[model samples]
Target chain A: MGDPQLSGEQVRQRALLRFDRVERAVHWLNASLFLILVLTGAALYFTPLIALVGRRRLIEQVHLYVGLALPLPLLLGLAGSWGRGLRRDVGRINRWTEADMRWLRGLVDNAAGRRPSAPRPRLGKFNAGQKLNAAFVAGGGLVMLGTGALLRWYVPFPLSWRAGATFVHNWLAFMFVVVILGHIALALSDREALRSMLGGRISSAWAARHAPAWLEEASDQ
Target chain B: MTEHAGPADELPVRGAGAEQPVPSPAGDGTQEPWSKPIGRRTVLSVLGLGALGTLFGSHLQSGISSALNAVHANGIASLLPGGGQFTIYTVTSGYPAAPADYTLRVGGLVQRPLSLPLAELQALPATRLTRNFQCVTGWEVADVHWVGVRLVDLAAHAGVNPAATAFQFRSFDGIYTESLTIQQAHQTGAIVAYSMLGAPVTREHGGPVRLYVPSMFGYKSIKWLSAIDLVARPQPGYWEQNGYPIDAWISGHPPVQAA
Candidate 1:
C-alpha cells in the first residue's frame, strides 16, 4: 500500500518503533513460559489430561518450575539501562488520563456498533484496553505466584491456608486461560498491533490512525 | 527516523534528552548487582545467606507442622496433598503370589506351631471391621469393610507363648516384612484380612490374605500375609528400617500427617 517496491529495510526505516528489542524479547519469553505453564498445569489438574499424560510427577515438577519462572522475564526486562523502554511503558500503563477514560467509553460504543462522538480522543502508545491487559497480567501474575508457591511447598502453612490457596490458584488459572484467549483473539484481529509486537515497529500511517497521540508526542520529541 | 520517538536502533531514549544519563529504574541496575565482579567475600556471603534461608525455611515448616498438629481440617481432606485415592506402593515389578499349597505359618514362641491352608484360615472365627484405611502419607479410604479372622483368635488357636511380646509378620512377596507389639496385635479391631471391598483381596492388594491393623497406619497393616513369627521384642520391619515409625498410630496425630 505505501510503496510496494520498498525493501524490508526501507519499510523498517519508515516505520515507527512501538516495542524495542528488549520489550519484544521479554514479551516472547513470557508467552513461551506461559504456554508451558498452561500445558503442564492442565495435565496436572484435569483427570483426563493426567491419564493422557501419565508422568504425573514429572508434569507436576515442570508446572512448579515454569510457574516460578514466569515472573523472571518481566523482572529482567525491568532491570538496568537496557530496560528503559520497558520501565517507561510500565509507567505509561499505570497512569490513566482523561483521554484513556474517553477511549474506554469509545470502546463500549465500538463494541455496540455505534459510531463514537465527533473529535474522538487520540490514544497513547497503548490504548486503554492494552493498558488494562498489561495491568491484569502484572497483578494476576503476582497473585498466581504467591498461591502456586504455597501449593507447591505448603508445609509452612496450616491445612486451612493450603486449601484456600488451592481454591484461589485453580480458579485463577482457569480465569487466566479465558482472558489470554481473548487477548490472543484481539491481537490477531489487529494485524498492525500483532506485527508491531513481533517486528518492534508499526507503519507511520497505522500509528497515525490508531495511536495519534503517541505519534504526535513522538513527533514533538 | 522522525517517525520514532527514540533512535531507529533497538534501545529507546526515555529521559528529556537522548544524551542524558539513564537513572536506575528500580535499583535492579546491572551496575550494582549483575555487573559486579565476583569476589571471595561476596561468594561466602551468598552461601551463608542461602544456608540461613534453608535453615529458616526448615525450622518454619517444622514449627508450623507442630503447631497445627491438633488442627483437624478434615472438611478439606480431598484437597490436601495425596488425600484422595489409595496410591499403591509396590516395590516388586510384579506382585508375588502364594503357591497353591500355601500354608500360613503360625510359629516361633507358640506352644504348638501350626501351618494352615487358606481355607482353614478363613474357617477360623471371623471379625468384620468397618474403619478408615489410613495411609501414612496423608490419605484415607473411610469406612472400609474388611472381613477376616481376628489376630486374637488366631493367636489363641496357635497358643501364643506368654513369653512372646511381639509378632514379626513376613510377606509371601519374600522381601516385605512388618512387626507389631503383641498388645497391638491382640486389639479387637486387628484382623488377618482375607476379603476387602466385598470381594477376596486381589493380588494388587496383596491377596489371598493381608493383615488389617485398623488402629494404625496402612503401612503397619502388612500385605501378602504368609507368616506370623512370635518374638519377645518389638522389631522394626521393612518400612521402619526406611525411617517410617514403628508405631504408626492414627491417633494423637491426624491421618494426613501420619508419617
Candidate 2:
C-alpha cells in the first residue's frame, strides 16, 4: 500500500505495472506514427498552413508515404494485442459512474479557480480525464482507418458521404493532436506519471493517489 | 482541497512513499524533471540535423519531379504514362455505365431548357484533351487523356441566356453538386468527359460522365455526372458545404493556393 501523506519522498513508495512492455511499445509506436501523419497530413490539407514544410509535390509525397506507413504500426499493434487492449480500454471508458462525474466537476471547478466544498474524489484505475483520452484515441483510430481506406481507393461513395468522411478525418486529426499534447503535458508535469510510462511501473504512493482501486487489484493479483 | 493560485502553477508533490530517489528542487514549483536542460552539443546537433533534413528533402523532391517529367517526354518508355502514376482504388459501388440511357438536362435560368440522350450528345462536335488530374487531398496524375464534349460547346448548343452567370452540375448520387462560373464552365480545357485513358469512362471514375476542369482541383470535376442546371448566381459544391474550399485551385505546392 502507498503512503497517503503528500510529500516528495513518499512519491517513490507507489509501484505497479499499469502498462506492460508490449503495451508501452505499441503506444509509443502509434504515437510517433500519429505525429508524423499529423505533420504531413496537415501540410497536405492546407498547403499554406505551414510554408516551410515544402512545395506541393514534396508535401504530397511525404503525405502519401506517411499515410501508407500508418497502417503498418496499427496492424502490428492490433495483431499483437489481438484486439484485447483496445477492447479493455473501451469497456473502461463506457462504464462511467457518479464518482467520475464528481471528479469531472471538481476538475472544472479547479480549472476555474473555484474552491469546492467537497474534497477531491479518489480515482480508480483512470480518472475522467484519462477515460476521455482513451475513448477518443480508440474512436479516432477507427475513423481514421476507415476513411483513409476509402480515400485511398477510387470507390465512389455518394458525394455527401465522402465529404462527411473527409470532415471526420480532418477534424479528428486536429482534435487528437490537441488531446495528445495535453496528455504529454500532464505526463511531463508529473514525475511519477512519466516514470510509470518509461519504466512500466508506478510508485505505490502514485497508484494510491491516482488509482487506489487499481493498486488494490494489482496487489491482489 | 488546499487552495492554490492556479492548477498549472501548483507544486505537484507525490503522496507519501510514492517519491522516487530523485532529488527535489528547493522551490515549490510544479515543473517536472523532464524539463531539465539538454547538453549544448545535443541542441546544436539537433538543429544541424533539422537543417540538413530540410535541404535533402527539397532536393529529393525536385529530383523526383524532373525524373517524372523526363519519363513523360519519352512517351511509351515511361513507367507511368504522362510522367505521373495512376492509382485506381476500387469504389464499393460498381462503376457507372455509359451510352448511358440517362439524359443530360440543362434547365433553370437558361433561355431554353434542353435534354439530350447519350447518343445525340456524343454526336455533337466532341473535344478531347490530356491534362493532369489533381486531387485536393494531394495526388496528381498527369496527362490523363480524356475525350468528351467541351462544356463551352454544350453551352453554345444550349444557347445560354446572357443573364445566366453560373451552372450547377448534379450527379445521380444526388448528394454531390458542383457549381461553376459561366467563364470557368466555358474555359478552353473544361469538358464533360465520357471517356478516360482511351476507353469509355468506368463507373468508379465517375463514368457515364464527369466534369473535367483542368485549372481546378479534382473535387470540381464532379463525377457520376447527371444534370447541368444554369443558374443566375453561384452555388457551393458538395465538398464546399462540408468545409472544402469552393474554388480549389491547384498551386505548385500545398495544392490550394493561399488566400
Candidate 3:
C-alpha cells in the first residue's frame, strides 16, 4: 500500500541511520587524538627520528600535553548529552554473549576473503571482532595513561619503575599502531561500512550481507 | 592489478556468482585496495615495505646525524650547553666572579695545601677528555671536551690525607656544592676544568675552574671555581637535598654503564 509521497521536501528516506552524530563525533575525535599520540610516541621510541622531530625537550613537552588530554574527548562525548548517545554505543561495544564466539570463528576467513558465501552470523550493533578491538583499545588507553604519567615524573617513582614504564609504553604503542592500521584497512575496503561511519547511513543490501541482526533491531526501534 | 586500475576494485570482496571463486590478484596487496586478507602474500608485502622503510628511514637519519656531527665535532656541544648557549641553573641573583685575587685553595686534610691563581693553574699541563654530558633533569649535550688538571693528579701533587675519603667541591656561587667519594674523585674523567674547546672556560659555563665528572650526573660536575675540602663522609648535594639521586647517570641508564 504505497501512500502518495510528499514530493517537495523528502529525497530518499529508505536508508538506515547506522550511527548518530554523537557516536560519529566520539569515534573520530578519539581516533585523531590517538593517532597523534601514536606518532609522537613512536618518534620518542626511535633514536633515528630524534633530530627530524627536532628539539627533544620541546617535542617531548608537546607529547606530554597531548597524552594528558587523551581522555577529554571521550569524557565529553559520554557527558555531552547526559549519556544517551555515546554511552549507549559504548554499551553495545562492550556487551558480549555466547553467540559472539561463533562470530569470532569466521573473522579470519572473513578478513582473508577465503569464505565469501558463508552466512554471516546475526551480529547486533557490532560484530565480535569490533567488540574485541574496542576492548583492546580501551585497555590500551589506560596502560598508556598510567605508564605515561609515571615516565613524565608526575609523582616520584623509582628510576627502575620509570624504565619499566618506558618499556611497556613503547611495546604497547607499537602493537596498537599495527592493530589500528588493520582496522583502517578493513573500513576503507568496505565502501558502505566506511560511509556508515562517516554520515551514518548504509544501504540495506550491505546491512543484510554484513549486519542483519543490527538492521532488524534498528527497524524495531 | 595494474596501478591504473580503479583502486577500490583491486580485490573485489563480493564476486558475481555464489558457486565459483574469483582468481586471487597477484603481487603485494599494498598495491591493491583493501580486500586483501592477512594471507602469505600480504605478510610478505608488509615485510617488503618494512625493509624499504628501513632503507629510506636510515638514509634520512644519516644525513641529519652526519650534519649534526660535523657541527659538533670537537666536544663543543658540552661547552655550549643547551644546544648552543649555556643553561643557567643558579639559585643566586648572579654568577660569582673570579676576581684576579681568585685562588683555588686545596686545604682540607692534605699534606701540602696549595693555593694557585688562575694564571698558575693554567701553567699546569692540561689533559682533555671528551665525553657525553648528561644532566639529572633529563637533558644531554654530547661530545664535550674539557681541558683541565685531573683531580687525581692534583691529589697526587697535594698528597691526599690517608684518612680522607671524599672531596667536597664548593662553587664560586657559594650556594651550590657537591661531593665525590675517593673512588669517584679518582675516576678517569674527573677534572678541575679551566678551558673548553681550546679557549678559557667562560663564566657562563661555571669557570675559572669547574669540576667535570663525565660518569656522574651534571650536578656532581659543580660549575664555578673555588675550594675542595677533603672530608670523611658523603654529604648530600644541593639538588640531592631536594630529591635528586646522588648517583645521577648522564645516559639516564645504569650507574654501571658509567664505569
User: What does fnat come to for each candidate?
Assistant: 0.00, 0.00, 0.00
Interface RMSD, candidate 2?
16.8
Pairs that clash in candidate 3: B75-B143
Q: Which ten residues in a row have the lowest lDDT in candidate 2 chain A?
A: A154-163
Give the runs in model 1 whose Cα sits over 4 Å from its true position: A1-13, A109-119, B1-259
How does residue B46 of candidate 1 score in lDDT? 36
DockQ, prediction 3: 0.05
What interface root-mean-square deviation (Å) does model 1 yield? Answer: 13.6
- Which regions of candidate 2 are displaced past 4 Å? A1-14, A49-94, B1-259
TM-score of chain A of each: 0.90, 0.77, 0.85
Q: Which candidate should be chosen as best, given DockQ against the real structure?
A: 1
Q: Compared with the true structure, what per-residue lDDT tens digits does model 3 show for residues B128-244?
A: 888766544333455777889888778778888888998888887768889887786654358899987568887757777898887776778887869988878868887777666
Please rank every candidate by TM-score, starting with the best: 1, 3, 2
What are the runs in model 3 whose C-alpha is more than 4 Å off? A1-13, A80-82, A108-119, B1-259
| lDDT for each residue of candidate 3 in A1-221, tens digit (9 for 90 to 100) | 11112222232235777788877887898888887887776555443353245344456667889888887777776665554655555655544433354577676667887774445445555666786676666656666776777666623554334434543555467678889999999998987789888998876556555665555555445
